[model samples]
Target: MHLPKNAHVALVDGENFVVMRNGGAPLEPKLDRSEKPDLSASNYSAGVKHQDDAGQALGRTDLEELAHGAAAAAWLNAKAVAGEIDDILVIADPKTLGEMRRHYHTELEKRLVGEIAKTLTGEPTKRIEQIIADA
Candidate 1:
């Protein structure tokens, strides 16, 4: 099925978000997953690092990560709302569902799918189709 053009895409990445947030580039205006803020090439499930929570692996998370992730998600939300995207797909931990929801209640949904979002919540992720269907 084709998604609506200018869909709200809520892309999430705990690690990169935190890095960029702390690293200082929120106003640089680039893709959220730009390689400039990569902490390192994490051998994650997909090698797609943006979805990973920057500090979830160490049992301790920083406000920077949380804020960064939320910021990224919010950016997507704003962009989507402005008709810049077609849909919003949160790529962080489902455990952060409540946090994500609280942070970005405007988003249609937040789901845990990748290693970082998974690691944060330590829970299995639901299917994207299923999530969209539910939404």
Candidate 2:
């Protein structure tokens, strides 16, 4: 798995992202965003919640999680189209990675070099590089 000389990598999670270029030091993302879940959503409301005999909610959804994935995908799309990045490596947790895959534009999809299903947003750059190298 040889990395392209100037390939870009993004370490992403539900709430944050850190972008880096392969041949250079890691840098702060040009576009960084964090979103709070909508408190008005039914899930957060004080209603008699439905539950099975086991007292489990039928399902769960998070707006903040969705927002983070969308923002990251949008940023990647913009950078790829602007020629700021040619190749891309994405490191994210399984769910966020799935969301990113769902939201990626065709152009950005073509630029994807690799996807690592692991959360690395809080990792230092040196550790990230080593992980990429090891992978």
Candidate 3:
């Protein structure tokens, strides 16, 4: 898809965040991935000991954090559904970004909700301004 006529911003953060903007800059500046699950031994054992079935209580905090990160990227696009913007291209990391391109055959058949055009990844923060030059 063609880039929107309106200037767009693709934002990325140090905590591994991805967001896109068109028609207007993103209002959310700081990435908020601070909400993480506490995976202390005491915390995990407490629920298992009492309920014996906390389901997923055995999971580690790192796993939960990564899942939240992916969800956060999806949420940004959901917020933009009403706008006239073409679409956004959000990339979490080099690996996922590469994966998206490599599995294009499979992804193309199923993925269409978010950005439509192929996009450059790796920290949208630095490249946000360069989009115009690149385009």
Candidate 4:
């Protein structure tokens, strides 16, 4: 849980994604909001359907949620491929995290430092830093 200085921390959910950078010591991370990139156009599940083993409709697919996850993954892939990130910690909701995992790029995998399966997108920066430190 020791976030190196200048490491990137990404907090994401189905609808929200926030990136922050550690601006303090590794043991006492001071996360500062970096940027909020617009990712509303990466929907890859527009016409996808979900079905059970019996071929019955499982439920309606959450298109917005799917889009957000896909968008976040694409963004991370781009950053990784471009060598824009040295280290990154991903903190996301369980479902979104799974979606992202399905689309992670090899480059992104290499830059990933850690992952926490929790929804911290709406949490304040201080709270996130504390949670990561405690973890």
Candidate 5:
């Protein structure tokens, strides 16, 4: 991927969110971790906990996972609205990516540079750099 200089890269998963900036040449990008937005303050709530018909407890973990995606989308939308983001690439687990897509703001969508649907939250920074370079 030919990320522009200083382009933002967001790596996210159900439980992790990271932001990095390309600080080197676009082709040989060097990623530096940037301070991420505090998503904990967002009013992202897990969906209904119980089945409406069966009255059985639905999977709490699943609902929490959905909230994670909502939080990410909300943060990104805020950045876009504030003109804080120039260009951005999103790297996320497939499920989270799908969830985020459903909530993407038009402004955010306009600034999107690319997206890779794979979980890389646990990968080392060097590995991530390599992956982005290869993309």
Candidate 6:
């Protein structure tokens, strides 16, 4: 698919995310993973009890990772709201995409134009652009 000129593409996964602007110049990273540390399950679980109101043990690993992904989505949302981006194309794994959908603000939801349900966080910019263009 041909992306709109200057469309913002957000490549995200549970651990990291990067926002790229598609333009005459090569895809340049607007926001990168440098802001957040690479966190492990142990880091998020330390001192945090994984239980429900009934004290039943609950799985928090995925949930914690989802929250991190949502946080990355929120950052993109803020940028969109600020008019820093015109449109959005989200490329992420199914789970991260679901989390992004769940946590998106109303304004950001309206700005979304495309989605690719695959993990491409570590893919090179040219490769990602080719994949999207061919999609």
Model 2 quality (TM-score)? 0.71
* 25-87 per-residue lDDT for model 4 (tens digits): 898999999988888756666325432343325433565786688799899899999999988
lDDT value for model 3: 0.35
Tell me the TM-score of model 6.
0.71
TM-score, per-candidate, Cα-based? 0.39, 0.71, 0.34, 0.87, 0.85, 0.71
lDDT of every model, 2 decimals = 0.37, 0.67, 0.35, 0.84, 0.83, 0.68
Q: Count the backbone clashes (under 3 Å) in each candidate.
A: 13, 0, 0, 0, 1, 0
Give the Å shift of residue 106 in candidate 2: 0.9
Flag the better candidate by lDDT, 2 or 4: 4
List candidate 1 segments past 4 Å from native. Answer: 1-11, 17-59, 95-98, 105-135
- Looking at model 5, report the run of 10 residues with the lowest lDDT sum: 47-56
Q: By TM-score, highest first, what's the ranking?
A: 4, 5, 6, 2, 1, 3
Clashes of 6: 0
Q: Which runs of model 3 end up more than 4 angstroms from their true locations?
A: 7-65, 80-86, 96-127
Candidate 2 regions with alpha-carbon error over 4 angstroms: 24-60
Candidate No. with top lDDT: 4
Weakest ten-residue segment in model 2 by summed lDDT: 38-47
Which model is ahead, 5 or 6, in terms of lDDT? 5
Residue by residue across 72-135, what tens digits does model 6's lDDT show?
7778777778887678888998877877786677788888878999999888766787778767
Candidates in order: C-alpha RMSD to true structure? 13.4, 7.5, 11.5, 2.9, 3.2, 6.2
Please estimate how well model 1 matches the true structure, expressed as its whole-model Cα lDDT.
Answer: 0.37
Candidate 4 has an lDDT of: 0.84
Query: Which pairs clash inside model 6?
Result: none
**Where in model 5 is the C-alpha error above 4 Å?**
41-61
lDDT of 5 by residue, 79-103 (tens): 9889999999999998789878877
